[model samples]
Target: MGLWFLNRPRPIKRTISVILDFLAIPFSLWLAFSLRLGEFYIPPNQQLWIFVLAPVLAIPIFIKSGLYRAIIRYIGMDAIWTIARAVFLYSLIFSVIVLTFNDLAGLVPRTVYAIQAIILMLFVGGSRMIARWLIVKSDHHLWKEVNAVRYIPPVLIYGAGRAGTQAAALMKLSNQMRPVAFIDDNVTLWRQQINGMTVYGVDQLAKLIERFKVRDILLAMPSAGRRRRSEILKLLEHYPVHVRTLPDLMDIAEGRLEVSDIQEVDIADLLGREPVAPINNLLSKNITDKAVMVTGAGGSIGSELCRQIIHLSPSCLVLYEASEINLYQIERELASLALDIPVYSMLGTVLNQQRVEMVCRRFGVNTIYHAAAYKHVPIVERNTNEGIRNNVFGTLHCAQAAIDAEVETFVLISTDKAVRPTNTMGATKRFAELVLQAFAESKTLYNKTRFTMVRFGNVLGSSGSVVPLFRDQIAKGGPVTVTDPEIIRYFMTIPEAAALVIQAGAMGKGGDVFVLDMGEPVKIVDLARRMIHLSGFTIRDNDNPNGDIEIDYTGLRPGEKLYEELLIGDNVSATEHEKIMRAEECVIEWPALVKIIRELELANKHDDCQKARAILLDTIDGFIPQCELSDWLGNDN
Candidate 1:
């Protein structure tokens, strides 16, 4: 019956509080008189009006103070403060009324009014505290009864700041997990209590995990930098607990998310470097009020480029893609995000010179970002002719079209694999770079298009990236395949990469090759281990036979290198942007490059894979075939 009444409608509960306050106010005055007189004294007829006036004055004050508006179960210090102020005001008015009436009807001691104020304050404030306790206890009891069979895991919050306290409060209301304590790096916070959870030093992590049986740690440091987060993650990785983090501070500040909206640790945090803040001037230099187009606009890098470009307020945006579904998806997304900016989605391949040129002319394109290519190494290796046709000739078609349309800027998205190539894909990418370099130097197309190439290594979350592949393999519950234990690759978040690309494009002189500073190389095997451990899984190996995930080294695939390089040679110099550098690498002159393109075109036209391979080997200085030709069609020839 008590629980049912407590669970009554909010208005009914509020009315109950009003009735309680009404009865308590009069009773408090009577108690105060008795205490002051040192006997069981009843109010005389003259002072009887005082009892009625007490409630009449106090109830309205309490209501006006918003005392009843606060939810009883969630009441805090602020509500208590409100109660204090409201009661003091009511006491002052009641004392004046009593003193005036006493002068005419009956004598009332001055001490009685003071005593009444004290009693009334205690009754008003203490009752709400008591009610809050009762409501909280009842809800907790009901939750326990209903979820008796549910097992709520005990977890630790890793910060004791405001975000951490909010997360703790959220945890108390949730049935999924129970917060055990807090782990903080601040020594001053250690051994302190926050939101009913004890803060402990890093040294106490092992003990806390053991004592509480904690299987997860919630990182509530939303404002922490990537390097600091990486340090903390490295420390946490030593434990058996799975880790999750709240979104960035901006997200929380914008009200897009709450501290309790925790997600799996962002893989980018493991990179140990803060993303360089983008320069607004450089970001909008070529894009602002200029008609811009992005090829492969539906791809990982291409889509992110589109998202960033729209925010720069272009005159109009054009999305050119070969895949119909990719074009439609990106077009819909850009339409919503573009707002007032016009977004034109064109479905066509870069291989068609006429189509590519016509789209540029129709859109009045000022800048073109060429991202379409056969990027998957093994897939491209198996189709050498198709790889050359798309990566090399396709790039040629786009550059020629941009030149014909007199586009102001043409930025080619090149890969680290293009440096000192060993695969058909890399060779073709290098060839594509040469195509742009040759065009930039050509006298005939001089000053028509400022051609630039931004070269960088793997981007996290891009299509065919190892990060997602490993995550999927881990989710499936068993073996995670790695290409080689020794292989290492540089990684940057896709957004960061796209931002840098935009900035690099703005900084371009004709034929410039910009290399983005991809911080440090990470070993593939170590990355695999970290992902497994962070997911709360142990690696299965000779050392640990009873582990959750087994990492299997599949050896390097065809054309895959042990490590990737951003520059072909060491002729690199810093640019205005700290993360971007200009590489003074060799380039083929137009006449020679034109001859190479014609030979490759004839080879592709005849499906003569050997002839195409020979042209790439002879033209690209560092091109080295890593294995026998594996082209599915070339094998028969």
Candidate 2:
């Protein structure tokens, strides 16, 4: 019956509420009179009309107060308050009428009105509360019956604050997970009940986990700082529970995401370093109101650069990408952003000197962020000639075009591997940097464009980054591969890297090599372990033979490095932005660098990987091949 009423239409439910209230109002009055007289006293002729008048007056008042409009399944405090106010008004008017007409109404008891009002208030309010419980309970039972085979894992929510309470409420409605309790750092909240779930301290996590068999812990502290979150994650890492988190408070607030929309623990939370707020002046210096062009605009870094640039309100944004699909996706996204600024998406490779120059000239491009290049180390090592042609001559063509178009600023996105360069990709990137440096030096007389290179370590979530690969491996319940136990690399988030790159570019004078201060490098084995553990899995090693996931130590790939460096030498100076620094590195003059680039291009045309390797080794400083040339085409000279 309760389920039938719960599924009824709103009008039918409201009508039922009205009929129930009409019946309860007069019965409450009769009970009040009997209790006041201390007997089962029947009302006299005069007072019989008083009982009939009781409901007539109250019913209209209740209707006006919207009492029947409240849904029994979801009635809250406001609805209860409305009932209270309506009953009080009715009681006041009934008392005034009875006392004023007592002589004519045959002497009604003064205590009767007060007694009946209290009874009526309880009857009206309590029935709705009972109905709400019944409907909700019936609905839950029905849902459970329908999904009897589906297992809903119980979870513990961290942080017994507003977000946690809300998360618990949302979980109650979810079929996938059930929230069992809250774990908070606040000692005062310990053993206290929130939304019927007890809040416990971190020490009780073991008992709670064992008692409830919780396999996941949802982090509900959206407002907590990264350091605090990292500390919490470190504490949780000891337990066998998968950790997920709400997005940052800003993302939740602005994006309309709920606290219960849990996601995998952010990779940045492991870094624990709070990003320094970007300097607005430096961010907008080369971008604001300028015609900016981003080569490889559909790539990870290039696309992020575009996203940030649109907010700064550029006059127009030019996306020059080699891939048709990438260009289409980014263009569609920018169009959705709905900024008044014009966005021009051109499908063209940076390798075409004339095409790049024409785009720059037509767009009156003031700033060019050159980000197009092959970056995967092993792939570039195998495709040696193509890698050189793209990373080396691609940069050359863009730089030359920037100069020809008289573009104001040009920034090349370089990598940490470019420092010592054991891989073909890294060497080509270094060679590209040298090309820009030479151009910047030669243009000292004309000074048409300022060339800057921003070098940083690996960016999390970028294409070919290990973070996603490890996540996929962990999800697949298998061996997570690491190149070497001792291998370590610096890591930064893509957005932060892009913002710092922009700031660094603004600080560039000419021929500047800016090295971003990537935080301490993390060991590959430790990273793999942390990822596995945080994902609620244990590493399968000699000590833990029954562990969930195995760690496979695949020896280093061709041209892979055990460690990466950001600066070529220790001669580095701090820039205006704290995270960005200027490096004093060797630069080949334009005359010498151009000759080497032409030889590389000729070798590339003939598919001579050996000659190309020789040119790169002879040209780039500290260039060493980690493995013999493994070009798909034979490396015969």
Candidate 3:
């Protein structure tokens, strides 16, 4: 019973540490009397009867300081400060009692106050420190070992601040990884140690790597912004060691530190986020107390849009999605949010013109955001016809319905892929942009019915992006695949992408093709290695034999490129939002665009994959097919 009670961490027992301090109140009183006088003296009025009610006075003081709730092991300087403040005030009240009781008995000496206060504080404070010391001593043996049989690996963390220390403690608990050292950028911290791990300078990475044979370096610099991280990544680039980084401070797991939540750094960090200063009034102006509709609401980009829009107090938000499960997932989230505004989950495809028109008319949707498209490169490479139908026709269906419903603003979530492309997916999206560009070109275009497009690069962690692929491969315990390790692409967070889209949609004056200012591109190989390292693994290559993960290059896929360009034409002019730009270029008239779209639609309907590929190349500028045999694909079909 005694062993179990000692081992257990309980709320009542945690309070017991504080209660022990109150038990010393008698000594505190005795010392107070002794200090005011030259020696211990008990007045006739201050007989032992005062000690009987000491617990009553101490309980309020302890409760006021929030001392009872303070766990001894976790107590730090802040708690000590609170204790001092509470004790000083508590002493004043106790002294007042002495004065009041003097009316009943004889007077108490003033020197007694000084001795009592000093003794009381020492007793109360020393008990907590003693408890803390014992707890630390008990856990000392645990701080020395780690799990080798478990899935955990050995790791050395960077930084010794809040983020780093928390990460170290968490890694220890999971027993999946052991933290060997802390590699901080601060020179002063280099010789120091945290949690028994010596801190080293950033420059000593190679030495540390060689000495400990450390497999991975986990960056605990959650406070590091994009620019700083980019600089760090560049410095560490040539080391041939895998690198991983913590998520942005705000995004780190509910502001709690845990090892299982420790994730591999992905490409998002390389494309450091430039904070968005939203045109808030403009964004909330249209949606507030107005009916809003989002097409493709179940998609990664579209779902985020819904999440933000719902918070803006739209009179009613309608989520129009074709996929059943996607709709259910997003709908369940909104339902749980319990917002006052009506949230309707409508099942309907954007490509179904009549279905879209009916929903818009029925819901009285005043605002529309179009985000549906086939985005995968290799998949879209083969299924060219379906890609065009969904990209081009799906967009057309939603746009015309919004027009017929007299919607206020229609924002098309576009991509850098729409830029002059080598792939059919890019060409189809360019054609869709043209579909809006032609509608915007009309002399009859209305200020009320504004249409616009926001173009940016791949979003990190989106359904088809490299981040998830790298993460999954890393988890699978072997080779992490990259298509041409040198392939570079721009990346952004889904929320950042959605924010830009919302801001761009509001900025549009109809038919404007706005491009998001994506920061510098990141190489795929570096991204892979960082992910491997952050996941507590070293990359297997010529330099490291203990590496747990292997990087394999599969060569570029069909219709894919080493890089993608955001600007289709050089005539792009900056917008009000520095990150957004408007592009001016040649456009096929709506008549011609419609003609191409019709043919493309028919090709998809008849399964004429060759004809679909043929029309895509002729219609879109800068498109080149890696494979000429449309018939071979059709046969495989």
Candidate 4:
């Protein structure tokens, strides 16, 4: 019956609290007088009226204090403190009324009022606390009944700062995760209780994991330095908990924090290098107030370029992509940014010269960022005919159209694999570069269009990047694959790559090959090991045979080099930007390049794989085919 009453409507609960305060106020005053007289004495007429009217003053005080606004189940110490203040004020007012009446002055001692104040505070505050405890206990049991199939994931917060505390409070009220404790590097916070959970030092992480069976760890250190954050990630790598983190401080300034804001560790955080701020002048040089168009605008690098382009206040931006879905997605996203500039989404392939010419003419394109290409090495190697047709011929068509339209600047997004290539994708890209270089060499063509190419290494989170592959493999609790133990590759974030591309394009001459300074190359095997460790899992190797994940080396894929090179030759000079460089390499004349394009067109038309391979081998310098003609023949059949 008592449980049912506690669970009644809001009005009933408020009425019950008001009535209790009314009854407790008079009883406390009566007790004070009886104790002062040392007997169970009835109050005199003047004092009786004081006692009876005391509740009237106290009830109004309680209501005005907002004491009943807080729900009992969630009431905390702050709410209890408010009750204390309200009772003290009520007692003081009642005492003033008694003293002013003069007839009730001698009826009760001044000390009785003080005693009544203390007793009233206890009754009022204690009753609320008791109700809160009972409701919380009942709700917890009911929560368990509603969720019988799966237990909530237990979590540990890494930082004990304000962000960490806020995240903990949010997690506690969520059904997806339950915060178990806090792990702080600060010694002063060690072993202290925060919001009911004990804070432990970094050294006690393993012990806490065992005690609580923790499954996930949240990194709430939004302002931690990169080196310190990396150190913490390294320290937690060998444990068995999946790691997640909150966004930086900028996200918090936008709005309130929520449990859903926690995200998986970004690949950039693992790189441990602060990104360089883009130069405002260089970023806005060619883009501001210019008519710009990006082919392959739906691609990883192209899409990023479009996003950054819209912010530069371009007069108009055009997206020319072959894929229907990719073009639609980028179009929708740019439209939502609600920029004042016009965004034209055109459905056309770069391989069609007429279509490229028409779009260039229609838009009066001031600058063209040609990013469309068949970039996947293995896939391109299997389909060599289509790869050459798209990468080589598509670039030729775009260049011709730009020259005809008198587009001021044309930038080609090249790859590190284009240097001394071994595969079809790399050779085709190098051929595309040669095509532009040939155009730059011709005096008449150079006067019409300025063509430049920016070459860089692998971009993390790109379509075929290994970072997402490793993350997916780790999540499945199995063996992660690497091409070769000794293989290495340079990596950069997608945004950084796009920024460098824009800056490089702005600094280009008629036929310059701009190369980005891709930081040190990382070993693939070491990267796999580090990824497993940072996710709180040990490598399954010979030393620790009972590890969580195993690293497997599948032999290198076809046409995949152990390492990639950005510059074709030793003749390289630094540009104005620290990250961009000018590579003074070889180039073919327009006549020679045109002849090679004609041969490629004929070879593709006849479905002659051998002839096409021979053309690439003879045209591109230092070109070597890793697969036999029969290997491609099998794919063709």
Candidate 5:
């Protein structure tokens, strides 16, 4: 019941409002006549017929003034103006009808229209105000029906800006989550009341949290860049309150803002690096008025790149995806962006060199962003053949096709896992990187297309990321599992990773492996502790017996690492930008790498697991056996 009125049913409301509109007309007429005359006189017997026809005749004028369509529940000053117009028209017609009889001709003049209009407005418009009050009363009743909003843990909003105010109003409307107070850093708004709620100072956060029993603090500074937002989040992190943030403003699709727009706070907020706002002209320089093709455009990073690129005013955007559902979803989303840019989706895999080449030739694709890859480390470790086929062979196919088509630029989204790999997944990714490096060098000599790879660490909220897994485990009442107490990983937000990739694509010359500086690594155990505490629970261990939830150490899984590195070798040099660096590393020539690739491909065809493993070992140096080679061939668990 509480949630019901908070988010109402639209169709039922519209029908109810239309009925109230017709009834308010006669009600206002009686109130007007009785008020102006200073007495409650009954209508004359002959005049009853005139009042009946008055409603019928006035219906069109009222509709023309748009009064009939004015919703009582959402009414404001606009509805009042529409009511006034409808009233003047109705009263004028009624008076003119009486004057035709000549009996009351001299009694009422043209001024009666103005008088009746004012009276009708009072009763009809006043009734709407009454209706609004009733609806609000009912809404409030349902909201506090079970006192759910109050029980939802008191929350404080950080900003009082337009977006913050919008978030606050939405919170008021959503009875499930109540914002106890507003906390603005701005001195001008301190202590002032907005929509009847007192605005508190940011300095008063501690006092307010204690007094109000605040259990959550929503960071409403969506427009704040990463640096400012990180500072604000760090200040709030000290208190044991779950923190959430409004997503970046550019991503906010317009409508009356909804509650879903608010996102659970991410660890990337700690990264402290502000995203370089993409210069639209620079982003559009090459893609605008040109045809673009994105291979694996339905995968995590790939799909996002497609979504962002479509806005660059491309003449045509082609999505080449191996997955059916992902392709459909991306296509639908692109259509909704509504830029009127043509989108062509083809069902094809990057491993099929012929298919990839045919599509590039047919579409005349100018730019290609190769994003499809086998990314999950442990999963890829188990399916070694598939990983090598998809990541290495697949990339070879796309790069060849891009070269064949003479595409201007080709960017591959690489990962930190590719740096000095110990597992099959990492080795494949590294091999793929080497393939691009070799291709770029050969291309420079042969004078062909440009190729680049953008390498970065784990992006928050990707399909296989730890954040979502932790959130899900936390959502369920119980022990949150951490792989190891000392395990640490670098994190980057999805958008930030995507943004850097785009910027990297533009800055590089060719075959340059660009590495983004993912700020200081965070311990998995520490992250789990913060999550538990912020979720309004105490971590249980030998230290605190009365704790609510326990954090357990689940021994590391296959191909798991205690720590990860971003650079493979120390020969990395600073690029034009501060965060990006170009790593100079060893690369295998096409002839040498091709032999190993062919042997591996043949081994996979025969399901000869040993030969495949042997080929991988010979191909990538420093390939130490981290988890016993027996596990790779048989069920050794």
Candidate 6:
């Protein structure tokens, strides 16, 4: 009950503080005099009222100094200065009173007044410091007791440089985390001391973890490159301790450093792909001062392309999306950014040939980034006709509209699934690429529109991405699902992919199929285990059935592959950009491709799922359906 009262409200705490100061002032004065005289001294009647009135005089001054407003537990060294200032002023007032009264001046010894003033300063300043210490320590003890943990988890900070030292000093003051030692890659800094904490080499990490019982590692190499950081994370992945990385040097330079700046290791760290600096000229080549339009502008890839395009100083941006909510969301976000560029959100699908042509011509669009398509493999597999219509015919109509509108460039966002595909989604994406190729080579009546296709694998954090799924499953404290142990995927961040797409589109000399260099594919099973371990959860396997998270293998989904390829042929050549590669693949002539497209359109129009599948299988080279029957369309029959 007393504890409850103490914690009731800020006003109660402030009131209690004022009362304590009143009682302490007179006691401090008496103690000061007794200490100065080296005996139990009592003041004479004439000067006695001065010591008694000390509280009345000092309380008002302390209150004015805002002493009671500060939380004792959170008070810093600056509070000591406040206490000293109030005390010094009070001593001066007392001296003035003594000097004004002849009786008081004669009663108090001159040497005693000087000694009392010094002692008074100590009592006043020391009281607050002691109170702060007591409160902080008490709170720490209470928190530890409630947690039932025998010891606060000591964190070992990696990197013994300036950033690491600062992080260690900051973490030491944290009640929940204690900084134990430093682990640096520098051999010369090993065995050195920073703030009295020993710094050890990376070789000693295992021994130090065991010795100090380190529960987590704080990565503070803010200036380290992505390659070096990835190496450190990979090494730490084998350890049982949870890994956290600090914000980059930009954040530190902006004075945003905090305990919360330490974030969990992202999937990008595990991807181990070194980020390449984007070329400015390439990024803004076709976009600067030009009207740009992005179909499916609300989808993951499309939305990111829109974001990147706006920064390139496009004169105007037209967001053409099939989903009203998605279109509104991107439009609202762009509006909130308050960019000078004009933004027009058109609610229509790429399938609407007339609408696509109208939007292109209405905006005088210089470039069209076609990202509209059915991308999810299983969903597309279950809905074959819709997938082909959207992915295949959708690309055909959009490209045709671009040509008619005399657009300067048209870029189709293709996927790795399009390479020697086993899935209808991949086959449709491949067909979209073929459509662009056919258009680029055709004898057209309209102005020649440069048609380009940029193909890459999965992007991290996009819709239907496994990263978010694994994260959600881990957060729920359950069995994380893996499609197959052997399944491997190439992942890139959305921004990087968008940037590459823009650059690749700029390099296109019509009919060019550019494939961005997707770094080494990551195994799905390994990815799941690492995610669980990095999150401070143990994998529950046959040997450790009692562990935290269980890994469940659900087998592959429909139209899914164990691995995906970025290129269809060995005729791949490096471009000026090291990350972007150009591929030369066979393309059907305009006459043949137009005939095939017409048949595909008629088949889709009649809802002939079997005929559509047959056309895709026959038209696309090396295209193989997982099965002969259309299971999803049986109900329509």
TM-scores, in order shown?
Answer: 0.87, 0.85, 0.88, 0.80, 0.76, 0.76
- Estimate candidate 6's alpha-carbon lDDT, on a 0 to 1 scale: 0.85
- Can you write out model 3's per-residue Cα lDDT over 196-307, one digit (the tens) per residue? 7898887787888788777777878877776777667666655645567676677564755556666655455555565677878767866888899988899999899999
Error of 2 at 321 (Å): 0.9
Better of 3 and 4 by lDDT: 4
Give each model's whole-structure lDDT: 0.88, 0.89, 0.77, 0.88, 0.76, 0.85
Worst 10 residues of 2 by lDDT: 628-637
Give the per-residue lDDT of model 6 (tens digit) for 296-396. Answer: 99999999999989988999999999999999999998898888989999999888889999998888999999999889998888888889889998998
Deviation from native of the Cα of residue 487 in model 4, angstroms: 1.1
Model 4, global lDDT: 0.88
| Model 5 lDDT-worst window of ten | 1-10
How does model 1 fare in lDDT? 0.88
lDDT of 2 by residue, 14-49 (tens): 888888989988898889888988999887676678
Candidate 4 displacement at residue 500 in angstroms: 1.5
Q: Report clashes for each candidate as comma-separated counts.
A: 0, 0, 8, 2, 0, 0
What's the C-alpha lDDT at position 65 in model 1?
A: 94
Candidate closer to the true structure by lDDT (higher is better), 3 or 5: 3
The residue-by-residue lDDT of candidate 4 on 166-245, one tens digit each, is 88877766767888899998999998999888899988999999999997899989898766777788787878888899
Q: Taking the tens digit of each residue's C-alpha lDDT, what string does model 1 give over 1-637? A: 4477687999998998899999999898888878988999876676577778889899999999998899887788888888888988887787777666646334677777778778877887888888877777776787687568778888899999877777777777776678889999899998888866799999999999999999999988989889999999998898888998888787767745544478888999877879989888999999999999999999999999999999999999999999999999999887776389999989999999999999999989999999999899988888899999999989999998998898999999999999989898999999999989888888876767899999999999999999999999998986999988899999999999999999999999899999999999999889889988888889999999998899999989988899888887888899989999999979889888787788889999999888999999999978887877844554533
Q: Which stretches of candidate 6 lie over 4 Å from their true place?
A: 1-154, 160-178, 191-198, 207-214
Candidate 5 lDDT (Cα, 0 to 1): 0.76
The weakest ten consecutive residues by lDDT in model 6 span: 1-10
